[model samples]
Target: MLPPRWRLAATSVVVVGALGVAALGWWYADGRAAGPLDSVIDDRLISRGEGYEHLLWPLADLGSPPALVLGMVILVVAAVRTHRRPAIVLAALGPPLASLVTELALKPLVGRTHFGGLSLPSGHATSITAQVTVYLLAFAAVGLPRRALLRRALIVAAPLVVLGVSGAMVSLERHYATDTVAGAMVGASVVCALALALDAWNRARSARAARVPLSGQAGRG
Candidate 1:
């Protein structure tokens, strides 16, 4: 597994790339403006009909408001159980912050419409991505073992969850393909950036404390 810093960097790249793709589609393409690749993927997924929709509904529902609340409750419980204050704080604040930025800023700034409203970044996609990312980070901070089967399962499941939600949104015609992509990018980027910032703050605080005692001892000597 990558160190936290490396993971942050990787997620940052994804964020930038995904947002760029979304912008390109919004600004440059014609009506629908999803480009051939996104259009093709959306068409294929939509063609699968009721059977696929049934299969995807539950997974997609994970992105809903009630589901997000449940996820937050689970995160808080886990953080308290593990006594991870930083994790608790991060989990508490991160997703809401991401959602605010996405809804209040990016969505309006992009001004792309789908299903009759601004949809450059799907709000549901943003919620699910941010929620999952923060939860995973909280779990890791609480000392979830790297080799644990649950951890391994989460690693595999995260992308699937994002994809499922994005695919469902597209298949259901709730968002354009680029909207979900941008949402995922924004959500992941915000959480990863927050984790890196918190880690750096803690490291700096520790270093300062370590140096303070040494300096005092030297002065006494």
Candidate 2:
């Protein structure tokens, strides 16, 4: 379990991410075209020439349905082996459910369409980011020796993976740059919120169990 201080920090991140998703959704409402920031971001984030396609294509495909399903299964199995039900739930259900909320709720309500498809939060970006978050948590759950290098490596790798996938989305015109940002925010927020809820439930259940045994002793006395 994450320390309470760490969980507080995570909750703060979730709040910020949710606000960001909402702000972008509001800004891009009504099928709006690429704004000033989108064009600028596209230029900086994905201006690499054709050779980059070799790398970018595969990174973007990591967010695809088949790839996400496979990754989720592997992560969930890892969590199961560790006997962490909260981690398992986050791994198994978090990404897909978050993706659905973006596709069905946010996109249509925003009415932002690109290439004849709803596109506020890029589903690809959402899936990829959430998957990475779950995998990171699962790694922690595995009870590996706490090594500074490994922790730093994860901190570096997670965002790199998200950025690579999001950059590919912009490069391919699969989504506007802001859409990818919103997708990332949605993915992170949902997963973090779930973690908070599960933690609270576990603490409450433990407290209740402790009370039950005390009540039994009191009855005998």
Candidate 3:
């Protein structure tokens, strides 16, 4: 069962981490720092960033229509499984929702460009996170009962795929460092929150059941 406080704590931590990463990105937006670490990030992301753009462009090319449809299909499939419908739905759509709201609506209206604009949040990263989170949660909801260790391993590994794909996009300049970090926060926060909330609800319901008598005794002698 979910511990409400811990769910809250996890959300809080993700927020804090995103903010920290954003600060670093902002500090280096102008590329002012000089050191081995800066050099490393720049070389991996900034320097060779453009070359890697081709890798993600194909995906971006699918655009909103196809992506949204595909996302919905996946969400539906995950939702139909066992007792994890809510978590799966939230995990599946969280990133895409963030991305769409930010990129299609917020960014244009706010008149922000990818470089200097409030593009600190990345839609691509969010989408990837949502997909990965959904897969992990769905796997957990269905398979954990059968094989605990393997399920745990998959849960651990799934996020890495999300991070790796999103990181590559960031490195390729498809998104600013801040944007990718924000996406990660959105995806992780929503999935964790939903899962915890469901668990807590179930626990509360079970506790209530345990407290109730199986048969009424009002007329007993």
Candidate 4:
């Protein structure tokens, strides 16, 4: 069974993180500080690639169009497995929508760019994080059953994928560390916010359905 506080706690964290990232965006908006912070981040990440640039490139592309399509496919498969209709729909639409907001809305609002693209929140990080958030929410919905090997594997692999993608984005200097953090926060916040809203919707429907049966029983009485 899912914990009663899980959604609430997760949603709360998402709110806090999003706000923090937004504050960071304001601080760095329009390339404020002249990228001093980003330069420091770059310096820290520069040598961490360890001559693994080629390998990291593919992993980093997990946030690209092809990888986003793959993530949607995984979500479709997971949605097929789950029972909730709202969740099924959410699994279908949430991640890509989050990615869009990250790229279209958040990026422009922050007004930070890297190499000709708006890049305050790394689009790649946002995409990957949104996908990961969906899987994590799905795992929670399933209650971490011992028999669910595939879900369990996803649980283990999700963070690693995020780490690899985020690391690659930073190591390659595609985005600063702050951008990755902000992107991640945006992705997680959007997904969790949608999930919580839908969960409330599902609960209300269930409650109404239950009341209908009780009201019918009362009429008969």
Highest lDDT among the candidates is held by which one?
Answer: 2
| lDDT tens per residue, model 4, 58-142 | 9899998789989889787867776657667677887888888887888899898777778878889888988888877755555
Per-residue lDDT tens digits of candidate 3, residues 117-144?
Answer: 4553456655666565555454454454
**The best candidate in terms of TM-score:** 2
lDDT score for residue 10 of model 2 = 62
Worst 10 residues of 2 by lDDT: 136-145
Candidate 2 whole-model C-alpha lDDT, 0 to 1: 0.81
Error of 3 at 172 (Å): 3.6
User: Better model by lDDT, 1 or 2?
Assistant: 2
Q: Which of the predicted structures, 1 or 4, would earn the higher lDDT when compared with the native? A: 4
Off by over 4 Å in 2: 141-148
> Candidate 2, residues 53-165: lDDT per residue as tens digits?
77778888988889888988987887788787878888888888888888888888888888888989889889988887776554553433268688668777889989888
Please give each candidate's TM-score. 0.85, 0.92, 0.62, 0.90
Worst 10 residues of 1 by lDDT: 24-33
Please report, as a residue range, the 10-residue window in candidate 3 with the lowest summed lDDT: 30-39
- Per-model lDDT: 0.74, 0.81, 0.56, 0.80
Give lDDT tens digits, candidate 1, residues 17-66.
45674674466333445657778878877777456777777867888878
Q: List the residue pairs that clash in candidate 1.
A: none
